[model samples]
Target: MDDDSDVSGLRATLRANPAGHWLSTPAPQVAEQLAQTDADFVVVDTEHAPTDLESVEAAVRAVDAANATGEDGAADTAAVVRVAWNDHVRIKRVLDTGAAGVMAPQVNTVDEAEAFVAAARYPPEGHRGVAGTRASRYGRDLDDYYERANDRVATIAQVETAEAVDNAGEISAVDGLDALLVGPADLSAALGVFGEYEHEQFVAAVEAVLDASTVPVGTLATSLDEVDYWAALGFDYQIVGVDAGYLRTGAAAALERYEQVGEE
Candidate 1:
C-alpha cells in the first residue's frame, strides 16, 4: 500500500475501533514484533523513552517490514511516533521517517495546538518542510506524498494540563488537528493529584476534557483493567500497553514461577 493509504486507513481504523499499543524500549525488533500483532496501531514513544531519531527511523522501518510480511495475517498496523515535545523540527524530522502520525505532548492552548498542526502539515495548510526522505521513497513518491500528507497525516495533540483541559474545545476545533490524547500521568500531576486517577479533582479534569473535545479523545492504559476503565468512560481510542510494562510483568512472572518450582 502507498504511504497515504496507510495513514488514511489508520484514520478509519481509529474511528471504527480505537485500539493501539505503545513501544517504550526503542528496539526495532520489538516494534516489528508488536506490529505483527492484531493492534490497530502502535505508538513509538519518544516522549518518555530513550528513542533518538535514528532509532525512531529504524523502528518505523521495522513496523513497515512487519506490516508487509503480515506473518500472522493480521491487519496492517500503523506506526505513530509520540515526539518528545511539540517542536517543529522534531515533528518534521519524525514525519520524514514515514510514521503514520505524530502525538505531541503538552499542548495547552489553541495556539500551541495550531502550531503543532502546522508543523506536521505541508504548505497551503501549514509549514512542514518538503523533502525527498523515506516518507516519499526517497523522492520516488514525493509528489504523491506531498499531495496527500496534509489530509492523511494524523496530528494528535496531548491534553496534559489544567490549561489544556480548559482549552480542549478550542484545541479540538483547530483545523487539521485530528485528535486529542490525554497524558494521564502528567495531567494528574498537573492537577496536584499525582497518580490519583480516581481523585475527584483528577476525575473532574478528565471529564472536562471529554466534555470539551470536538475531536476524538484517547488515553494510555497500562493494563487490561485500565483499558476497560477508559473504554467504559468513552475514550475514542487508547494505547493499551507499554513495552517496558510488558517486560517487567513478564520477567516478574517468570521469576515467580522459577521460585515456585524450586520450592516444590
Candidate 2:
C-alpha cells in the first residue's frame, strides 16, 4: 500500500506465468508502458487507494487494454483487486468488474479465511450470490461462468496478524485459497516487533506460515540480497518494492548521494 504500489496485474502475472506478457499497470498510459515491460500478471490495489466504484471500474478497463497488446494468446494479464477489507459485498462488487481474483486483507483466523473464500465463490463451491454482470462477459454465458468460477477465479488471503500466523495451517488448508500474502508492517506490529522481519521470533513466525501453508506463500522484499535470501528459503514470488516505496526511496537516495560541489 505504499503510495500507489497497486497489486492488481502483478498478482495475476505471478500466478499465470509463461503465457505472454501478463504484466499490466494501473490507470493512464503509464500502466501500459509498464505492462510493456512484461510480467506474468498484474493486480490493482483498491484496499489502500481511494478507489471508489467508478475508479475501480476504470482501472480494470485500462489494465485489460494493456493486456490486449501482449500477443496472440496472451494470458491477458488477469486483473485482480485487493479489496479494502474482507467484506463480502465489496468482494462481490469488485469481482463483478471481471477481476480474476481477490486478495483478502487482515485475515487473522481460519474462520475469517473461510469466510473470504466463500464470499469469492458461488454455490456448491461457496456462498457468493450469483449475479450476471460484467465479470461473466456481461452475462453472455451464465453456465460457463458458474462452471469456471472455482477454477479461474483465485483467492489469496493476507496473513498480517500474529494470530493469523498461529492459525496459518488451518487458514491455508481452506479449499479455495490459492496463496497467502504476508503483509510485513502489520505482521511486525502484531508481533510487537515493528520493522524487523529478520528478528528471530518474526522469522520463526514466517517459517511457520510457510510450513503450515497448503498453498504458495509470499511477502515483500526490497533489496536484491533480501529477495535472494527469501526466495532461497522457498518464497517463489515477491514484490521488489511497492510503487510508492520506489518513488520515495529514489528521492531520498538522489538527494543523499547527489554531489553538491562542496558538500561531503
Alpha carbon lDDT at 61, candidate 2: 64
The worst-scoring run of ten residues by lDDT in candidate 1 lies at 1-10
Q: Could you give candidate 1's per-residue lDDT for residues 75-97 as a string of tens digits?
A: 37888999999999999999999
TM-score of 1: 0.92
Q: Residue 94: error of model 1 in Å?
A: 0.3
Residue 150 alpha-carbon offset, candidate 1, angstroms = 1.4
lDDT of 1 at 254: 100
The sequence of per-residue lDDT tens digits that candidate 2 reaches over residues 95-204 is: 88877778888998888988998998898868887878877778887777777676667787888988999998998888767778888778988899998867888888
Question: Each model's number of backbone clashes?
Answer: 0, 12
